[model samples]
Target: MYGQGMDAAPNPWFSWDYVERNWDEVSDRLVIHTTLTLQAVLIALAIAFPLAVLARRIPRLAGPITGVSGVLYTIPSFALFGLLAPFTGIGRTTVLIGLVAYALLVLVRNILVGLQGVDRDVIDAARGVGYSPCECSSPSSLPNALPSIIAGLRIATVSTVALVTVGVVVGYGGLGQLMFRGLQSDYRAQIMTATLLCLALALLLDLVLALAGRWATPWLRGRAS
Candidate 1:
């Protein structure tokens, strides 16, 4: 029993020395993930917000547009990487493109939901007051849509984190490098540490985003808080 206990127990987490020794590598990889995710999300929002507005106006467009996004989301990440490798090569751009594409599914859907959730009476009142749709929607409707928009952003952020980790599988640097190397080398401690760090990062990102969204959109405080 004593021998079995010793054999079964394993230390699989990062130590202070491990983190200190690799601080630069870890920080650089985290920066890469942050930059990649931010760029991809911004691109997605740019495309998605317009598409969502269009979808709201011409309801018929929503079906096909969302269907296309759904299809893109279902494509295996590695497969998409392979497909893009020919054109973009195996670098950050290729990973960014894939991440943006994946993010669109969530962003567009959320934008659509947010737009649709705007109170029709409020919209009518705004129009009755001689306000243009764009102007009316910008402030009032935006508040109504704030919660949904925040939710979508949250989901997109999470997906971005996971996808960024997978980016290492395609030769793009991130925390996934630690995970991949640890797995390849049969280093249980490193693998566990990497996984925990990734999980912590995801949680931290979500909290920070939520706080930012709440602070930026006061209307959401009533509902999101």
Candidate 2:
């Protein structure tokens, strides 16, 4: 009698019936998951851009700025959630804070690298034409750095998507909640659904960014052609 339930067959990965019954729930969670990911990435970019620009302009500060973000990146995701939950109190806020912190390293490094990579010739030309450092940066520096910035954004956005699932630690992980519940119940369909959606979301976002990057950098296309 005690072993009877253990003899039952395990559930299959794709349970149409389960999805049919829970599609509304899945849709709601998916929206939450996407919102959290986008918000975190956007916030990180806003913070990282100025930091990257400052680092580029002041070479001495570059190391320390990147170093701090690198340190934040190195901390395990779940551990960060655990640490923040105490102060932020376990929810979207705690999760958003953690996601944003983790994204900084990639976003900052990429933006700085992109800025540094801009043709020195362009900077010299801008100076030769009477552009102030400030005027030159807006028109010449950032535009030239777009590819690298876009690349950084793509990486940060995808990384944020994955990190959002860790929000389960704070009871705010959108699809992550489903994965957690599935784990407890050994429900294969629920876990697979959430995992697949996460993967799909990442791919979709990456594709969109890739397209956007191309659109923004027509010179590269012109050069290639």
Write model 1 residue lDDT over 38-125, tens digit each, in one string: 7888899888888888888789999999999999999999889889988998889989999999999999999889889887887788
Poorest lDDT segment (10 consecutive residues) of candidate 2: 1-10
Residue-level lDDT for 42 in candidate 1: 87
**Most accurate candidate by lDDT:** 2
The 0-to-1 C-alpha lDDT of every candidate, in the order given, reads 0.81, 0.88
Supply the global lDDT for candidate 2. Answer: 0.88
How do the residues 6-30 of candidate 2 rate in per-residue lDDT, one tens digit apiece?
6866578888888889999999999
**Candidate 1 Cα errors over 4 Å, as ranges:** 1-12, 128-131, 139-141, 217-225
Task: Give all TM-scores, in the order shown.
Answer: 0.87, 0.91
Q: For candidate 1, give the lDDT of residue 10.
A: 45
Regions of candidate 2 where Cα sits further than 4 Å from its true position: 1-10, 127-135, 138-141
| lDDT for 170 (candidate 1) | 71
